[model samples]
Target: MNRTTRHLGHRARPVLGRSGVALCRIGWLALALAVPSARADDWLTGAPLARQLASPVDVAWSGSPLRPSLERLARAQRVAILLDRRVDPDRPIELRLLDAPLADVFEELAAREGLGVTLCDGVVYVGPPETARKLRTLSALKTEEARGLPAAVSRKALARAAMRWEDFATP
Candidate 1:
């Protein structure tokens, strides 16, 4: 087996007595129930409208240097950006935009950067919500597409973009 598979296989088999196994199974079941499963409906409905609004008092970051500001904003905005690398290839990233309609902005941004954009229901998701707005405003933004996931890029791609944004932001 490959190194990764071998490692996973080793980790999957836990050394537990019968009672331990039973307890583990019970714990897993409890967790399964506690964590709500994602459904198509959840994606469509999104967070409530009351939760969707953003406060102007929130600080805006240009990039990684300003991640603290973004994190603070997310607490109130109920929005967060998931960088492409941080997301599972199988799952769509969640995006919440406030104060602006995202359709055209997303399309233009993706095209300019040759990134991918997808819109489902009212949400516009690009790489991640954190950088999506800034990206859309870039003059370099071109035409965007509602295509399937873009080519897999590195996790560092997001860090780089965020840092760039911070650097460009006016003090």
Candidate 2:
């Protein structure tokens, strides 16, 4: 049996199944409507999106539908994850971790579903890998363009601007 769910550094595709989760119109208000028994995880790292990617999260799930699991994770982390129409919200994802960084989880999701996650402004932008790659390329181009400014600016300012856009570029 070939499993699609990726865990930690390993990667795999889901064996056989299809599902979709709609994140649209599902904000915190909607999350409150989820199953009463669902509990939220704590946000251990008090860092920005870039650093928060390495935040530790304890997850234990088995054959859980992609949508609800993700919704729970998002709520726990106090982050909003918006799903693109191209994603299958109902897809099955399995995860077991005593303490794994958020990036590892995101990578697992990508390995299983060919999805790309961009963290910014307390929101996660998820979509096809190709789309994500293109966004990153565009962001890098923007950074390069800034380097070509007619007037030479301080290294600090240029670095800050590049860092700002780099977050959006990476998954």
Best-performing candidate as measured by TM-score: 2
The TM-scores of all predictions, comma-separated, are: 0.24, 0.51
lDDT (0-100) at residue 4 of candidate 1? 19
Model 1, 153: alpha-carbon shift in Å? 33
Predicted model with the maximum lDDT: 2
Residue-by-residue lDDT tens digits, candidate 2, 34-136 = 3233322222222554465567888887888877887788766655554654677777777787677776777667766778765322335567877554433
The true-structure Cα RMSD of candidate 2 reads: 12.3
Q: Model 1, stretches more than 4 Å misplaced?
A: 1-59, 66-70, 86-124, 128-171
The lDDT values for all models are: 0.29, 0.48
Give the per-residue lDDT of model 1 (tens digit) for 77-141. 43332223333333322333344422333333344444444322222334444443333222112
Q: List the residue pairs that clash in candidate 1.
A: 62-165, 62-166, 63-162, 63-166, 64-162, 81-129, 81-130, 107-144, 111-143, 112-142
Model 1's alpha-carbon lDDT is 0.29
Error of 2 at 84 (Å): 1.4
